[model samples]
Target: MELRTLGYFVAVADAGSVSAAAAVVHVTQPAISRQLRQLETELGLELFTRGPGRLSLTAAGQQFLPHARDVLHRADEARAAARTYAAGRLERLTIAAPTTTLTDVIAPFLATLTDDDPMPTVFESDPREAYPALRHGADLAIVTEAPRSTLAARALASLPVWAYVRDDHPWHGRDAVALHELVDETVLALTPSFRPRQILDTALARLGVPLDRVVDCSNPQVAQALAAAGRGVAVVTDDARFGLWPVQIVGRDGPLRIDLFAAWEPEHHAAETLAALAARLGEFCVERYGPDVAPAGHVGQMGREY
Candidate 1:
C-alpha cells in the first residue's frame, strides 16, 4: 500500500473520525474516505467501525496499529537519515528523558562533552514515552525500560532509590530502612509518574504494607523539602538535598531501583556513531554511579521495578 494511504489511515485513527482526519491531512473528506476504503480493500481487512460521529478501530485494526506506526516511523527515519547523508555528517542530536535524569545525570554529562561532539538538546519526558519521543523527533531516548528488540538499547545504570531524612530524624544515621518500615512513619513520595513512586507503590502492595500517613508530591525536590521540614520521609531517586541523609530503600528481596536505558533507531545513517555515543554515556554512568551500588548509602538491586 502507498505510504500516503497509511498516513491517512493513521491520521483518521488519531483524530477519531474521517472529517477530522481530512482536516489534519489537508484533504477533502470524500477523498480521504475513498483512500481508506481502498486501503482496506487492498489489505482485505476492515480497519475501522463507524459510529454516530466517531470511528473506532476494529480488532484487526487494533493489532495493526503498532505495525502501522512502525512503518511511519521508519519512513520518517529514512528521510532524516537521507538528510544527514546529504549533509555529510550529523550536526546535532536531541535526547528525551525524565526530568530528574536531565537535571542530575545528563546536565553533568554535558559538561564533560568535547568541542567535536554534536550539539545536543534535551526533551523532558517519562521513560514510557521514549519510543514515541523518538518517532516524533528525538535522536535518542533515555528510559527506565530496555527498548523493543527492533531498536538499539543500551543499559546505562541502575540508580539508587533512597528514603531521605534530615540529620535529626531517627532514620538519618541508619544504614537503610526496610520498605515495610515506612508503614509507621509519615512518608513523603512522588506521584506515580515517577519510576521510584511506581516501584514504591508496587512493593507496598506486594508486601502488604499499608502506609498510615503518605504525602504525595509532584516534584522530588518538593518531596525532599517536605521531608526536611520533618513532615515525612521522602522516597525518591534524586540526589540528597536540604542537608538530608540518604538511606537505601530495602524491598522484600532487595533495594528499590530505577534502571536506565538509552535507545535509538538501529538503521539510522549515523547508527554506529549513535551506538558509540550511547556507549560513552553508559561508561560515564558506571564511572559516576558504579555498576551496582545497592549495598548502603548509594546502592543498587538486581531485581528492577521500573
Candidate 2:
C-alpha cells in the first residue's frame, strides 16, 4: 500500500469521519473515502464500519491503526530527513522545553553543535507540543513531565526552582520572603497550555498558596520582562532566574525544585546522535548549572491531588 494511503487511513481513524479527515487532510470527503477504500482493498480487511452517523474503526482497523500510524510517521520522518539532507542539513534537533530551560540548559549545550561541521538546525518548542513531535519523529525532547505509560524516554536530572522578579522589584531587594507571601504578590505566569502552569498549580495545591493575581503570558522572556519591570514575582528555575533577570531569589525556603528528563522514540534510527546530544547536554548542565540540576523540572507527584 502507498504511504499516502496509510496516512489517509490514519487521518480517518483519528478524525472518526471522512468529512473530518477530509478537512484535516485538505481533501474532499469522497477523496478521503476513496483512499480508505483503496487502502482496505489492498490490505484485504474492512478498516471501518459505515453507518448513518460517524465512522468507527472495525476490529481489523483497530489492529491496523497503530501500525499504520507508525508507518505514516516514519514516512513523514523520511521526507523531513531527505529534505534536510538534500539541503546539507544532516540533523534536525527539535527541543521541547520550557522557555527558561531552553535559555539555561539546551541553548548553552547547543554551542557544541554550532561549532561542529554540518551543524543541526535546532527547533525550539514548548513542552506541550514536544510530545506529539516525539511521536511523529522529533530528534529529542526535554520536558517537565512525561506522559503516562510512555516508555520512550529516560529520566535525566532534577533542578532547583527559584522565585525571581525584576531587579528593581521590592522582592528582589529582599534576600528572602515567606513562601506564603508569594500568594499575595502579583505574579507572571505562562499559559496553561505550557507545562509551567501545571507545575505552578501543583505547587500551589501542595503549599496551599492562593495564586490570585496572575498576569497570563505565553513566553518566558515576556514573563521575565514583566517581572523585571517590578510587576511581581515570577517563578522559574534557579539557572533560569540567573539567565533571565538580575533578580535575587527571595523565597524563605530558597526555591521549589523539580525533575527534568530527556525522552526519544526508542526505535528511532538516529539514536546515536540523539544519545550523544543528551550526554553532551547533561555535561553542559553540570559545567554551567551544576550536576544536581535536572534537565527539566518535575511537578506532578508532590501531593496526592496531583
Highest-lDDT candidate = 1
* Backbone clashes counted, model 1: 4
Q: Candidate 2: global Cα-lDDT? A: 0.66
My TM-score estimates for the predictions, one after another, are 0.67, 0.57
**Once model 2 is optimally superposed onto the true structure by TM-score, how far is the C-alpha of residue 141 displaced, in angstroms?**
1.6
lDDT of 1 by residue, 1-306 (tens): 999999999999999999899889899999998999999999999999989989999999988888999999999999987887676456788999899989888888988889888899998997778889988889889887656777876677888889999999888798788988898888899888778888899888889888888888999999999988989899999988899999998888688888887788866667666777877887788777876732222211221112
lDDT of 2 by residue, 1-306 (tens): 888778788888888888888889898888878888888888999989999758999999999999988887888889988886555443546666666777777667767666453354456777667778777656677777744444355555656545676555556555455667767788777777766566666667767667779888877667776776767767655354333343323233445555666776655665545555666666676677666564444223311011
Q: Rate the local accuracy (lDDT) of all candidates.
A: 0.84, 0.66
Can you list the residue pairs that collide in candidate 1?
293-299, 293-300, 294-299, 294-300
Q: Which ten residues in a row have the lowest lDDT in candidate 2?
A: 297-306
Number of the predicted model whose TM-score against the real structure is largest: 1
